[model samples]
Target: MSEQPVPVTTLLDDEAFLGTYQPDIWVFVQRSLIIGFLTAVVFGPLIGLPPEYWLPIMGFTTVFSAFIFDDYTSWLNHRADVWHLTSLRLIYENGNAPEQNAAVNLADIHATQRKLYKNLRLDLETGQSVLMKYLTNPRAIERDIDIARLALMGTIADEADIPTAEEANS
Candidate 1:
């Protein structure tokens, strides 16, 4: 039996789907660890537990809180924080809230900058900026965004003008 290809889903009318960007799994893991550690530190001392039990209590609390926080963050925050790149625009959807969703036209993007710590910053022509956090391989994503922006602005005249992945790497 032959395997069939999955269909690409586009978010916008008349726009081709380029890619989808989500926060890296490591980001969630780090967040969960930090929050869990802080929680254990803050509450472990208040319970009036004996010195001998403090280590075990704190360890259990850290693990429990980390697991719960990881699940909650993954479901509520990480899943909703997505960037859908269409041929024409960058669509951002925040959680389950429709009012928080936004779309930025590729043509209006002045430049894309890869900031410190997995953040991609989009500077707009209007002097405004949008920051996307915890993106995996943000440098490559920045390049992809630039290529899309150039294509939308009619700067790329031919397919040959666009660099291949190998060429880009070199």
Candidate 2:
């Protein structure tokens, strides 16, 4: 059978030598945008009316807040960091934004777990992990780690070959 093509992963931060992938906050941005537009429609016109149009005024303010808040949040999320796994190791870097980074050897990794929710979190045996709740592409990130884990296991097939010098002495 022919081997399938491997997908390409990208870096996401610079502040950290290595960083984990995070999901985008697009959903949050979209929701905020909708609320802003709704408020404008309901109150923008009434703001010019009598002082008794306080309801409209409040709506207008809400819309304005949503627009400003969502815009900034989305803008920031666009700069989220990313995590990647190669055949030999895991890498954390800035996808488009700058953040601290680090790299952990796959041989040292003990386990990896993916937590799915409003945000995705990756727990690694390396004791170092990242929490990216607002990242845009979480599935891809998890997939990368899973691939790495598989590759790692393949490299150390025999229990005698597993790295245990440090732990055994301790």
Candidate 3:
């Protein structure tokens, strides 16, 4: 399987978001529910009240939107790439797209880095990184990469699969 680069905006498309079984779906939905609940708690009871009372609700909800929903929105903007590793090269494709963005020969890969913050960040040896946010289990992603790397190392390269350094030097 090859890995591909995808645009951050591609998340806006439903097909792109659901194509992969991103465990983060629950986290995103749960956070959204929390935001909705918090908004309701602060304002739902006061909605029918007088303007003076509803003022507080409006203020609280606004703050919640700015703070909590902002995080969610950022998560929503995030994207994850599913890479395909062949015998000789890595093929990258957007989890959302059918076409590949680019291919990196195994020998050129300087390093593979994974960052686990609020989300899962996959960085290629090429310095390109993809952020998969709000995932329930980030370790799984890291493990997959580790396995991929090992498998790639054992897989022999073919002339048609990728250009060798010797060939390049020639």
Candidate 4:
């Protein structure tokens, strides 16, 4: 049961906060390439933009559409996303979508499970759980959660920490 709790803070600057994480951009890049190809083949001729200008037009359209539409969501999701562990809670921020960000108190997390080896599922006390997927390295996050869980269980008195996976790896 992992219902999200209200976020007490938007983006924490405290050292305890693990810091913001931008998901891998490979998917976005691939999609952009596909969109560009299709635009050049179809929209270019249809718009009478000229054969010579097709590539430029396609490139502009691809980048423009991506940034305004696809990239906007992804970029905002990446930029606004935040996650961290505090003594009292396991915070997961999924960017501000209509201001829907929330947190989950550590004490409220009854269980944590790794799903499909790359997904982190958190079972909350309320019988609702949150699954964090597409995590570049779920193992690292899983390990951090475990450490924080241990700390929450009185195994450690000081504040807990979740180490960020290396940027290159993540």
TM-score of each model, paired residue for residue: 0.59, 0.43, 0.41, 0.49
Give the alpha-carbon lDDT of every model. 0.71, 0.52, 0.50, 0.63
User: Which model is ahead, 2 or 4, in terms of TM-score?
Assistant: 4
TM-score of 4: 0.49
Which candidate tops lDDT? 1
Per-residue lDDT of 47 in model 1? 79
**Which residue pairs collide in model 4, if any?**
1-124, 1-127, 1-128, 2-124, 2-128, 2-129, 89-106
Residue 84 lDDT in candidate 3: 48
In lDDT terms, how accurate is model 1? 0.71
The candidate, 2 or 3, that scores higher on TM-score is 2
Clashes of 2: 32
- Each model's RMSD to truth, in Å? 7.5, 11.6, 13.2, 10.1
10 residues in a row with least lDDT, candidate 1: 1-10
Tens-digit lDDT track for model 2 on 79-150? 445555565556656545444555556666654444543345555566666565554555555555555555
**Scored by Cα lDDT, where does model 3 land?**
0.50
Residue-wise lDDT of candidate 4 within 1-170, one digit each (tens)? 32434445754554255433334455446556677777788988887777898888778878987877766575445544556666556666654653666777777887677775245788888999887654566666766676666676776555334333453136
Q: Which of 3 and 4 is the better model by lDDT?
A: 4
